[model samples]
Target: METETRDITITDIRKLLDEVTDPEIPVISIHDLGVLRDVRKEGDTFVITITPTYSGCPAMDMITLNIHGKLRAHHIPHFKVETQLAPAWTTDWMTDEGKRKLKEFGITPPMGSKGSEDLINRHPPCPFCNSENTELVSAFGSTACKALFRCRDCSEPFDYFKCH
Candidate 1:
């Protein structure tokens, strides 16, 4: 018996990649994170482009490995995962569904663009209680990309998915 290969379309590739999740945040897929920049075929080889949430993010290596593993699982033989850093990632790239998932997982998604004076005075509503009474405990949380915050109304400590 011999195995047959079929031409992979962008949708097919995306469907495969959709199963790849961010190691840190299991609730959201990498595709929802907006890290997956592009996927295309180049001379029978699949090319996957990704951007890290931030420079030196430890999760990138694992993400790349997972991409390779996923492609292999789909029986894809030749593929390349490339990292692009020119256009920095922003919280704006995150999908609304992703944000909802984050909130449901107890991580408050970015409220808006970072460093805005308006955003400075505002604290993200608590994911647990939806209270506006939240305080920034620390600028950095379990990960550099997140911040530590505590809700005054609910008395719950949570991580805020900081905007980039």
Candidate 2:
């Protein structure tokens, strides 16, 4: 009698990748961030593609490591994490759940598309106070992908995830 081996499927790999979270933003999973682009199988090896939110995102290294670790933990022996930079990652790729999670984490989620001078210039509603009266204190926040903002109504300073 011959034993039948189960081939790994994209769905299975996605579930495992979903367990991985962004090192910087622990409140949301990478899956929700739309980082895990595509998964495929080549014989015994599984190839996974991902795109960083920014070209020079510092979290990409940690994110890649976490992805490998997660897959290894699940007994995925042969696999590779490929970085895809072609189309680039945009704020629009972020899942609705991710946006909600960011707001719940007290960080205002980005409202408009990336590189939209007019749109990005518009103040996003405060996550803490839900007030539109906000001011950009700094173009850069703790991370390059965020901007420091203060709500006039609540006088609370918060990070606004930049659209990129």
Candidate 3:
């Protein structure tokens, strides 16, 4: 079975891509996570731009593969997945829905925008118990972009998606 590509619009492509979730954080789609930047049709090719949460993020490879798989599955024959690193990715780009999803998934989302002064001394509340009494267990969590934090009240360990 093939999807009718001739009538497909950029909006249609975006809807399809919304189904693609991040490999590391499955609760949020790439678009909400602020990874999927743009989707536009140029000539006959659809160009999809994505930015990594960080430059050296390991999930980029899997993300690209997933994007390709998604487009191919929808019979989108001509498309380009480009990784744009310039200007860099910031926590501010993440959607509010994405943050809520992250909390529901037991991970603390970045509380402030990247380079914000509050973020310098801020402690992320526990997603499970919403306690401000949290201690940094480790600067690095399961992934480089997250930090391991232990909630004093809940006594639960959670990963905080670091700002920037």
- In model 3, the number of clashes is 0
lDDT of 2 by residue, 1-164 (tens): 22121556778888888888989889898878888788888777788899988777889999999988987777777889999987888888889999999999998888877764543467889998799999889878998788898999999999998877
Compared with the true structure, model 3 gives a TM-score of 0.93
Model 1, C-alpha of 127: deviation from truth (Å): 0.2
**Candidates, ranked, lDDT:** 3, 1, 2
Q: Deviation in angstroms for 59 in model 3? A: 0.7
For model 3, how does the per-residue alpha-carbon lDDT over 33-80 read when each residue is reduced to its tens digit?
Answer: 999999988887899999988777889999999999998988888899
Off by over 4 Å in 3: 1-5, 116-120
* Residue pairs that clash (backbone atoms under 3 angstroms), model 3: none
lDDT of 2 at 88: 81
Candidate 2 Cα misplacement greater than 4 A, ranges: 1-5, 118-121
How well is each residue in 45-114 modelled by candidate 1, as lDDT tens digits? 7789999997879999999999999888778777899999978888888999999999999999998664
Worst 10 residues of 2 by lDDT: 1-10
* All-Cα superposition RMSD per candidate: 1.9, 2.9, 1.7
TM-scores for candidates 1 onward, in order: 0.93, 0.91, 0.93
CA shift at 111, candidate 2, in angstroms? 0.4
Ranking by TM-score: 3, 1, 2
